[model samples]
Target: MMKVANPPKVSPPANEALTKDARQYGVVIGALAGFCENGSPLVSLGDRPALTAMTLVDVGEQHIGMRVAVQFEGGDLGLPLVIGVVRDNSGVGSSAGASAARVTSECGLSATIDDDEIVLIARRRITLRCGAASVTLDSDGNVEIRGKHLLSRAAGQNRIKGSSVSLN
Candidate 1:
């Protein structure tokens, strides 16, 4: 009778080691490479090739080189999803006391909140509009207020001061 020997078990590819390792089942840090044709983000995990991924947090072209935390759904065979952006801690101590919150839009609108004040910034103009009333502030330092009927009332005094005050 001939002796029979079992074949050796093959190991998984090195790139797939992340999913195979039980210890790495948790969130993994990845760099945002770019976006696919379908708008899905492509992430690079260490030396592995970039893989298309979904994101729970909003990501734009501006965040292409940002670091993000990726979590695999189900298990090693599940899809990869970007959970959150990893904030850079280098500037953590730049603001000592006040905590700031900021929101920026691609259309050149930004709002920032720091301590007790809120500041709004825009590239061209900032306008507040209602039914027939609108106030506009332009980049040229022009302030325009329009309304059907305008009234100025103050508890103590009301003053209208400008380079040249006009009343008609």
Candidate 2:
């Protein structure tokens, strides 16, 4: 008689009759419709009913037309839960919704609302880098940098007024 090398592990048969939870991708059609006691954002998903999702702990806002991933209840037992947002599909840099302010990180880079007031607080140092310019502010608000600089530019005229003008 031939001996079996090893028996393969077998999983118990799934109960197809019962609802099975699954993860799915969908787009956020509506937002800010309502909120749960825990402050979870309730949003209407594409074609499906509205459901509340566990958002980022410090997420200030979620807007419509944002693509999101959701977890569907097993065997269609109940509404699905929003798991996370799909960043690549999110039209962040486009001018579609230019009026709104959005902050996000994608592809190893962080994007902030252009020309908007932003405050960065760091215990040690804060560094910003761009292809054209960079800024650094130390804990004591003293910094040194190398670059062509501009103080201010206005449509009508540029003014530089100070107690004393010294050029070296």
Candidate 3:
């Protein structure tokens, strides 16, 4: 009787072989976050390291500054693939579909349509606040306040020009 030993598996050298791939997180930059061209979402770590990522699905047209996670096959930065956008605590940079951008927070949910329509739907009320002015729109739509306070102050001249002027 004789016993035989099998040879060990051979692996390429570490330096000569391609590194195993892993997911890396980065921020989206450039003009339109590289979403306008197509489904390719460009992710950038800084100025030098940037690559066009092939996403699982179209991440839609995102804002200039958005967080994204990408995976590089065989640790090759040149062949990066996009997973999805990394949503922050505020819930911005969320893509509902290939043409929709949504943001949900404690305040409310806001979405930006690809065609340039911004729709804000709130459970309670919606408030727009500025430095010295504010507009409050309630859910019922019965109450609409143009400004926080009533004031007639114009830099040049105050003119009330309308088709019909009625004071109640």
Candidate 4:
């Protein structure tokens, strides 16, 4: 016997469709890289002279972690995460749950993950493009760094062979 043709798939309800965005990425306004009428204020992200949406030029992600490049449109200058800065991918437009903002490194990594850092990924990488100084990993595998501002590494002197590295 010949089988009957399948009917057209039923469309989701309007409210349901809207919920999809809220569930997956987040609010619709926050998702766009442009002005959002009902989105979080620009001040919430950074204190730029003229806050605006940052364009995602590039993105570096690891598992649950992500770093996106935000191109400032001459409005917000010198603002780190707003444009040339890096922050954890955990709370992109979240009003709360912001652990701390992070910065990117030369080794294609994100550092200074806030205690708010999302541990969803084993080891993640974000980018906050900025020029930073170099440190010598001493003979004993210890590098006593000073005046450094890498939030993550500076917190702990991990894997320092023998010498003491005062990160403070």
Q: List per-prediction Cα lDDT, in the order shown.
A: 0.67, 0.45, 0.51, 0.33
> Among all windows of ten consecutive residues in candidate 1, which has the lowest summed lDDT?
91-100
lDDT score, candidate 4? 0.33
Over 4 Å off in model 1, which ranges? 1-25, 90-168
Question: Can you write out model 1's per-residue Cα lDDT over 25-134, one digit (the tens) per residue?
Answer: 57887766666557887766655556777789998866755677888654442356888777757731122124554544334455555778877677888887889999
Error of 1 at 53 (Å): 0.5
Question: Each candidate: RMSD to true structure?
Answer: 14.0, 12.3, 15.5, 16.4
Q: What are the per-residue Cα lDDT tens digits for candidate 3 across 1-168? A: 765587666443343233432323343322223432344555554333345656664565444346566665445556556666666577877432445544433223333346567676666676667786767777786444565568789899899876797998
In Å, residue 135's CA in model 1 sits off its true spot by 39
Q: Give the candidate order by descending TM-score.
A: 1, 3, 2, 4
lDDT winner among the candidates? 1
For model 2, residues 6-68, the per-residue Cα lDDT tens digits are 977744324543333232233322222234446665544433444655554323344433445
lDDT of 3: 0.51
Off by over 4 Å in 4: 1-107, 116-140, 145-168
Provide the lDDT at 146 for model 1: 99
